[model samples]
Target: MPRIPGGATGVVLALLLAACTGGPGDAASDEEAAQSPADPAFVADNEAWRAERRAALLEPDGWASLIGLHWIELPAHYVGSGATNGIRLAKGPEKLGMLQQQGGRVWLVPDPGAALTVDDAPAKERIELLPDVSGTPTIVAFDEGKGQLSLVDRGGRKALRVKHAEAASLTGLGPLEYWPADPAWRVQARFVAHPQGKTIPIMDITSRQAPQPNPGAIEFEHGGAGYRLEALEGEDGGLFLVFADRTSGHGSYGAGRYLYTAAPDAEGRVLVDFNRAYNPPCVFTDFATCPLPPPENRLDLAVTAGEKKYRRP
Candidate 1:
């Protein structure tokens, strides 16, 4: 597929699953719409949900805030906004701090009175940092909460990801478009559990290979054709589906889209609501590292339910 290189926060992902109801549009009249209860909240709720999604994506530390992704190569590198620093930050203090890697452990040593915070608390000296792969990551907040620094482990390589609230992409975001909601696209599927310890090779936009846990697969039928999508377990134990369809490069985001579904019931059945599918962070920012859909997850059918393409303005 084409490369469209993309943070997706928890709240934004939650809204994608909960607020998108794949049914009809608004009612004939105001009274009729609000009075008749055929999934009456569909239209109104979706509008409000889209607004929140946009706001969240533009948050101080959202994907739009991303400014740089510098790989940590040396044992210790000076981090600052000035060009003189080894790892120059796009926007931050002139000489913020230094990152030193000890015997497999990394520490952040702040410059004298550089004004950095560890986990929102003042960092007068040095502090250990955890990579994003770890469950808990140490956020080096600086520039008074507008700038954030963190370590990200990509394919066994460590890098410092930088974010600033005043990124140009945040202000240049164009409008988001979507196809009219269709209940028919919100089909059902059955979850088939994979053997224990099953995993799938996930490829990121940067062409890095990362093995992701594959708990199971979602089996469903559309257009009289059977399909299966590899399922990855999310933080809440729900099924996270990153997939591509015929619309991928035609009308939708060239990279693909994402969908979240509830865990399967005892019968191993889950609802695959395509209407709730959304574009990945790559749709908005090139810095985002979104995973590509595996071979099994690429469908020949055109999924015209969720979001449409976002042309940068």
Candidate 2:
């Protein structure tokens, strides 16, 4: 997989002359959306999906909840808001706990009398944990559950990602604007599966490199020009696409946008719907780990659709 999920690209290059395609889990959510429905009901469904996406983003622990990302550089460091801690927290209690890293393992030892919880239950003892990079990460909840902490593994570096319900992004986010929905932008694509167990290099905004599962590439036609995009394995079992278009920096997030598509059917047919495209989590919070679009996924044409650049207040 890709190094960071900020929040969390393209079809691979060998197929650039070909075609291709994360947010909101399974995307517009209508895997069975008619090939090109321009009807009012279809439009309404897309609107509803967008509303859900907006709500999800503002969840207490959603991307907007992120407030800080502190790298764990030292072997042992105290974490808290006090000035004495080695790894000082920007928020939370003055003396939360101690973090000890040794022999490739990290453990959290909460300070006595500090009110901390492990996954919602009171943290009565020290806890061994893994970073978000490999498997499920343990959430260290503090400040009476209003704030929480978790470990993230980025390019072999472990860091703490802090989140809180009071983070500014949750209440300060702007409304999402979209280009007029059009059925024409919903192009039909064909999935060409790669050989069993193939992976490709994925470069993140930080320029870190990692091999991501490359199930195959998706080929499609848009505006009379044929194109292809390399597909990454989405956590939801569908395909994830990272792409950049002519709108970058002008009307969209400069790095690019992301989209999630349902798995190709038996015949390998899929819909590359532009209306469902969305901004990466980085657009909302600086604490995110977003990946950049692979060169192959950069499109010459402007994709005048989907969520626009998020203007931070």
Candidate 3:
């Protein structure tokens, strides 16, 4: 067999199964095509959206510029020695500033007459300070212990608090990689309802204690074998699945990829399209805490669909 670029052994299995089953015009192909939204129009739209998002994430002026992450527990006063202090402002290098903590508030004194901003907003209450490297001075204040950070945008919104950090996503170069868009892997599985919703205990990478939301189980048949998948509820209210099959560690992400099925239809039927399975956030950055697949979701059969393991950068 000619080797396919970026192809793995699992993909070969899926192709063999597809070849043995039927031709391109088979009913199964029709069903798989209907299930997959990879029709030219939808694929074009999806590609456009993904490219836009990727550009936003990778842009230098965007959140990817966040390079500092410090956790403070106690109230302490410190002076910013531009070189010593971890905080780096783009305005200049090695500029000294005053950082005072009083009543759970942090106040920063940038040079006198200089405009100060948080995240990207101009400082509301400006403080006068002595000149260091820059003659102009300004003051920026922040609530203590809040997840907010002060951004000094000289051009627009000089100072504002941004929730996401720039370096966090910038360093996340391990974007999800998927198998080729093959229709054979699109299997129509039946949803077997567990009247009493099933609960799957997930051990998160953070080692945090929490019970993952396993709504129920799904039963499907392939290659004369029976397989079952337990469903999990995601924060977005969409259904997520984390399952490991015989191909784990060999041909797929050892931790498993995530699959989302749309909310059940009026008749309570949901499509489990493996083609959309993707890598979890943990694949990209170590800072992310991802959930592992529960024992029940693990299968004995090889699932040759969705995304393959991400090669960390």
Pick by lDDT: which candidate is best?
2
lDDT of candidate model 2 versus the reference: 0.77
lDDT agreement with native, every candidate: 0.75, 0.77, 0.49
Q: Count the clashes in each prediction.
A: 2, 16, 25
Q: Residue by residue across 1-313, what tens digits does model 2's lDDT show?
A: 3211221123222132232222222223322234444789768878998999988987898888888888889898998989999888777989988998988788999987679998678896888767887678899998888899999887787888899998888767788877656677787899989997998787765556777788899998875788888888875557899887766655666677898888788899988888888998888887877776777787766676787778887
What RMSD does each model have against the real structure? 8.1, 7.0, 12.9
Candidate 3 per-residue C-alpha lDDT over 1-313 given as tens digits, one digit per residue, 9 for 90 to 100: 0000113434533432332333323422333333333567645654554566456646643444343323323343222325555443323324334444445344555544333455456554533322211333232322221223442322111222222333444656446554445454556676656556566676544333356556676777766778888887754444677766654555566666677777665555666767666666555544333565666766766665666766756
Better of 1 and 3 by TM-score: 1
> In candidate 3, which residue ranges exceed 4 Å CA deviation?
1-176, 195-198, 235-237
TM-score of each: 0.85, 0.86, 0.54
Candidate 1 global CA lDDT score: 0.75
Ranked candidates, highest lDDT first: 2, 1, 3
TM value for model 3:
0.54
